[model samples]
Target: MKLSALVPLVGVALLTVVLVGGCAATEPTPAAPGGTGDGHGHIEGATEMPEPQLRLVTLDSAGSLTAFDPATEASVSLTDVAGAELLTSDGRYAFAAADARLTIVDTGTWTVPHGDHSHYYLAEPRVVGMIDGGAGAGLGRAASNAALTAVFFPGSGETVVLDGEALGEGEIEELARIEGEPHEGAAVPLGEQVLVSSPDAVQVYSAAGDALGDEQRCEDMRGSGITSVGVVFGCADGALLTVEGEDGVEFERIPYPAGATPAESFANRPGRPDLAAPAGRSGAWLLDTREREWTLIRTEQPLLRAVAVGDSDGRVVAIDALGRIVVLTHEGVQATSEPLLAADLVGAELPAGVVLEVDASRAYVNSPSAGLVHEIDYVDNARLARSLDVEGDASALVEVAR
Candidate 1:
C-alpha cells in the first residue's frame, strides 16, 4: 500500500481538495434520504474547516479557470470560458460543457458527508451561471452527497433538476424539468425520485415533478454514475440499479458478463461502490457496486481513462493505449507510466476532455497533449505523484472540494 508522496499541484490552471470540517459535527447534511434538498448540507457564507481543505478545479484549452493547492501550491483564478468542451463535477459544482453550453463554476470548496463526520466549506470562488444544456448533456451530481443535481439531456429528453440547496446558496434553483423520449439517454436523482432513460423503461420522478412509475428495464440507457450502492445506468443489456427504498426508487438489472463489453461510462471515488469502466479493448471494468460483480481488468494497452480507486490496494487507475499510467489490481500489472498521454494518442482517439481524477490519496492524470498534471501515487506503485504545473491545456479536469 505505501503511498504518501503528495506534491503534484504546480502553478495551477485548476485544482480542488477542500476537505475542511473537523469539528462542527452535529450531523445535519442528511435531508435527501428521499431526495430533493433541505440543506445543501449547510452553506450561507461558508467557512468551516478543521480538516479537509484540498482543492483543484482546473479547465483549460482556452477556457481557463483555476483553483489549486495540492498542498500549498496555492492558486486561484476561477473564471473564463469561450468554448469549454466538457468538464463535470458535483463535488461542488464545476460543470463546463461547451456544445449544448453549460457554465456554472463555484469551486469555493465543499465536502458535506454527515454520517459520522464531514462538513468542510471554503467559499469565494465565483461564476455560477449559464445553462442551455440539452443536447447530449448527461450529469448526475452527488459527490459527497449534496442531494438533487441530475442534468441528463440526451440530445433533448431534458431532465435538468438542480437545486442542491440552491446549489449551496449561489443559486440556480429549478428542482424539476422532466420530459422524455429522446433516446441516447440516462438520468438520476433517486432520493425524492427521478430516474429517466426511456426506450425500454426506467422513468420514475418527483423531485417536485412527480411521475414515479417505470421500474427498470434499461435497453439502451447510455452512461450514468452516482454510487454508494445505487444509481448506475448504462444498459445495452446490463446495469440499471437504483437505491433509495422505502417503497420508492429501487431497481436492479446488472446483466452482461457472458459476451460482456458494456461500460460506455462509469468512474468512481465519490461515494464509491467500486466502479471503473472501459472494457472495450479488453481492459478495466471493475464495477463491484457492493458485489453485484463485473471485474475485467485486462489491459495490455488501450484504456484512455479509468478510475475506481476503492483504495486499500483495490486500485485501478488506468490511461493506457500508449498514454501510459496503468496501475491495476485483482492481481495483474502493478505499475507503468512513461508515455503520459503520448501526445494524446491520435490513433484510438482521446479527447472528450480526458480525465482520471480519483482522490482520498492521489491519481490525477490529465496530460492534455503535455501541459502537465500527472500526480499519481496509486498505492505508490503507479507512483509519479507530481507533475502538476498547468497554465494551459490541461484540457478540463475536475477535482472540486474533494
Candidate 2:
C-alpha cells in the first residue's frame, strides 16, 4: 500500500478500540434476506416511509455536501456545503457545522421508494436552518432533537443553541454559548444531555446547558501521553464515542507507577493485537457505567482526523485519514470500496486520495482532488455507488432521513 498517504489515516486508531462490544441488549433481529428489496414486496407500513434508512453525506473539498445512498448505491442529492466541519444525525434532519448550512433531503427517494410520498418529500426538500457556530468560529460538532439543535465549536470552546426551525437559509444568529474547550474529544448525545470525552475526563451536559456533576477523570492528566483521541467508542443508551490514544498507556493515577503516562499504563501484554504497522496514533475505546468497566478496542493504524462508525450487514464501516474506506468487523478489516480519483472530491485539486463516513450500512468516501464521492455498501462489501465532480474537501459526514 502507499505509505505516505496512509500514515495520517491510521493516526486515529488510538482509543477507538474501546467501543466495539458494549452495546445494550436488544435481541438481534433476524438478518433481512439478501438483495436490495426489503423482501416484504412492499415493506410493512409502506405508506409511512420505512424507518428512515441511513444515507451517508460527505463534503467534497470544493465545499459541497454530496449525499450518498447506501441501499441502491448511488448519489441521491447534491447540496452546496461551505464551511462545514461536522455532521450528525437523529434519523430526522442532517445537521452540518458552523456555516449553519443544514441540508435536509428525504431519505426515502435515495433508495427503493414505496409510494408517491417519496417523490413529494424530495421535490421540496427543506432548508431547515442556517445558524452560526457562535462568534463566527467554525462548528466542530452538532446534536439535535425534535425541539432544538445544539452546535458545538471546539475551536471557540463554545456551544451554540438554536430553535431548530427558527433559522433557515439566509438567516443567522448567535444562540446561547457554553464554556470550555472540548479537549481533543468525541461527543455523544443522550436525549437531553451530551457526553464528551477528553484526555483527563469525561463530562456530561444537559440540553439546557448544565454540567451533570459526574466527572470520570482518567489516570493520566498530561496531554502528551495521549497520542490521538476520539477514534471510535461504545456507550450506553445506544451511544458510542471513539477517539485516539497511545500504546502502553500508563497513567500515574492508575497505580502503574509514579510519572507513568497514559500510554505507559499498558504493559507487555498486548491488548489489541490486530493493529497494523501505522496503528497507535489513534484507536477506539468502550465505556459503560453500568458495567463499571472500560475496554480498549484495537483498529487499523493512522486513522482519519475524525471518523463516524456505523453497523450494517453485521459489519462496521470506517473512513480513514487519507479518505481510504474499509469494512471491518470482529473478523478483520477488508478494503472493499473502489478508490476515488482525488481530483474529483477536492476542489483545490490535490493528489487523488480517499476518506469516508459510515452510517447504518453505507460508507461514503470522498477524494477531494478528484472531486468525487463514492458510496459503498458494506452489506456485501460492494461498490454500489458513485458520484462525480464534487467540490470542496469534505470535512465531515452523517446519515440522515432526507
Candidate 3:
C-alpha cells in the first residue's frame, strides 16, 4: 500500500517501491559472481553490483536487524542483536551494541570509489560476529576506513580495532585492543595505527598495541570521521584534523570562533572532507576539512538533527524542532518541508532513534511513530521523495552501499 504522505499545502508526487511482502524478511538472493568485476579491481568474496544502490539497515526496539533496498524495495533479514541499543555503520559494515557486547554485521552491499568513478558490490548479508568485552564494548560511536574498523567503549576505556578485510570474510578478528582510563572518547582506524582519543588527548597506537609519538591535546574530544584527506575529531573548543601523508601524521586544530558552542558530534557522507552537526537548537555547524575552516549555518527554528550533504550547492539538510525537514545553503534557509513529525517531536523529550541520514542525492529520516523511513530530496525543495517500510520498526537506522 502506497500511503499518502502527510504533507500539508505541498503536493508531493509519491512513488511506492514494490515490496516482496509487507514485513517478514527471511533470505536474500544467494551470492553469485556478479559481472561488476569487469573493469574495476576485484573484491574476493563480493560480487560487484551494477551500480550504487542505497540500502537502509535498521535495528528495531526488539533487536531485529534488517536491510531494506530502496531500488528493489526488498527487505532482507541479516540477524538479530540481543539487547541492541545502538547502531553505527561505515558504509559496508554496521556495528551494533548492547551494554557489554559489540556486534558487527555485513550488509553484503558496498561501494568503492575509483578515481572519479566508483564500483558497487552485493553479497548475501549476514552477521559477522560479536566483540565481547568490558561493561559497554561499543557504547561510543564506531569509525572505519578502507582497512580497519575501530570500536570504542567509553565506559570501559577500551578501543578494539578489527581488520576490514577480515570482516569481509565474516570474521571477528581483533587487530588490537588499546586500554585507557575510562572517559568519553573516540577511536579512529587510520592507516596502520588506531587513533585513540582520551578525555583531552588523541594518541596513536599500532596493531601490536604499542603507543606511538605525537599525542594531540583536544579538550572533551568525542566524535571522529575518516575522510579522503584525513581523520576529523570533534573537540570542546573546535575540531581537530589529522592527516597521515608521505611525511607523517600531522594535526591541525580548527578552533571555533569566540563564544561559539562547539558541536557535540559530527556526521556527513562518508569519505567526504566536509562534515555537519547540530549546534544548539537553532544553528548547524559545517566544518570544511579541506580548507580547515568552520562555518555555522543558522536557522530560525530549533533543529534536532543536521547532516552536511557536501554537494556542489553546499546543501545542508536538517530537521527542525517542529518536525519539518529544512534545507539550508550558504545564503541560509533555502526551503522547508511540511511538519512531518510534529506529533513525534511535540513531547518534552525527543524519542531515542530518529535521525537524519544523507547520501549523494537524498536524505532519509526514520519515524518510529510511523514505522516508515521518509526520503527527502533536499535539492528539490525538501520534497518527500518517498516513504519506505522495512521489516522492523526502524528505531535505529543507517544507510550503506554508498
Candidate 4:
C-alpha cells in the first residue's frame, strides 16, 4: 500500500492536513477473472497496516533536544535549553526541564485509541513555548487528568505548576507558586487541587495558591509518578497513594513490609499503575497501586534505576552499577541484557546517567557513556534488537508512540 505524503499547510502554526496515508481517491484497476489480483484489487486475508510504531526523544548533555523517527531515519532538532535533564511526556506534549526553565515541545504526533487498535497522525513538530521556572528548576512531571505540568526547584524550595490550556494557547499560566523548605520535592495536579511537598507531608493547594485540605504525612518525599489508578508519592515509611473518590480525594499509605528499608523515591511506567524503586542494597520494590500491594524482589546486582512495566505480574527493568540491564518479576530475574553501558567511570561521572524507555514489547536503554541506545525485545527473552548510535551523550530518553 502507498502512504500519502504529509503536506504542511502554509501560514499555519505547526498544523498539517490530517489525512490517512492510503485513503486518497484513486481508480481501482480491473482484476483478472477467477484469480486474486496482486496489486490492483483487494487481496484475501489482508489486515490494516501498522503505522510507524515509535519515536525516540533524546536530551543531550548540552541540553539540546532532538526527536528521532526511526521508521524514516529522520531526526528533528527541537531546541537548545541549558542544563536540561528530566523529560516527561503525557503521550502528547514533551516537557523538558532545564536549570530554570521548562521547555515545551509539540511532538506533532498523537494516537487515538480504539477498542482493539489505534490511529496515528503526524504534523509539523515545533518548540511550542518555554516557561521561566526561576532558579534551580528541575524535577519535571505532567498529569493528564487536570492538564497540568509541574517543575520543582529543590535549591529554591519552589514549585511551579502550569495549566495545559494556557500552554496550548502559547501562554504560561502559573497554577500555583508553592514555597516550602529546600528539599527534594515533587508536585502533582489533581483537577483544581495541586499537591506540593512539605517538610513532613504533602500539602494540597488550589490552583490559585490557597491551601486546601490538611497536609498528608509523608516524610522525606522525593520521587513521584502518575498512573491510571491515581497519583503516587514515595516517602520514608512507604508510598502515599491518592485516588479520586466519590466525596473527594482519598489517601492511603501502603507501608513497606516490617523491617523493610524505606525507599525515598519511585518511578512508574508512563501509563501503568505499578511503581518500582530500589528497596535496599540489593532489593527491588514493586508497588501495585490498583491492588494496594507491595512486593520486594531480591536482585543479585545493586540497582541504580528501576522502572515497573507490564500489568499484573508486571516486570521491573533496572540498571545496576555494573551497567547491566536486569528484568525481574515478582518471582525472580526473568531476563538479563549484556552490559550495554560502560561499568567504569567513578563518582558523579560514573555512567550513572541511564534511562529506560519501554513499551509493550520492547525496552530502549540509553547509556550516555557509550553514546548508544540498545533496543531490547523484552518479550523474546530480552533479545537485543539494535544498538543505535545516537552520536551524543544523552542525559534523558523518552519513547513517543504515534
Estimated TM-score for each candidate: 0.33, 0.52, 0.87, 0.81
User: In model 3, what lDDT does residue 39 have?
Assistant: 31
What's the candidate order when arranged by decreasing lDDT?
3, 1, 4, 2
Ranking by TM-score: 3, 4, 2, 1
TM-score of 4: 0.81
Shift in Å, residue 322, candidate 2: 8.1
Give a tens-digit lDDT track for model 1, residues 1-402.
312212212222222332235334554443334333344455544667765666767788888878777887787888887777777787777877676667788787777677787767676788868777655654322222446777765666677777665565567887777777666666667665667777666778787767867556776666778777787888887787788788877777777789887888888888768888888888888877777877787877768678888865577888877878888898867888787778877788678777888888887866787877778887777778688786676776878666
Q: What's model 4's overall lDDT? A: 0.68
Error of 4 at 118 (Å): 5.3
Residue-pair clashes, model 4: 0
lDDT of 4 at 197: 82
For residue 39, give model 3's deviation from the true position in Å.
16
Each model's lDDT comes to 0.72, 0.40, 0.77, 0.68
Q: In model 4, which runs have C-alpha deviations exceeding 4 angstroms?
A: 1-53, 111-121, 136-146, 343-352
Superior candidate under lDDT, 1 versus 4: 1
Give candidate 3 misplaced runs (Cα > 4 Å): 1-45, 136-140, 346-349
Using TM-score, give the best candidate's number: 3
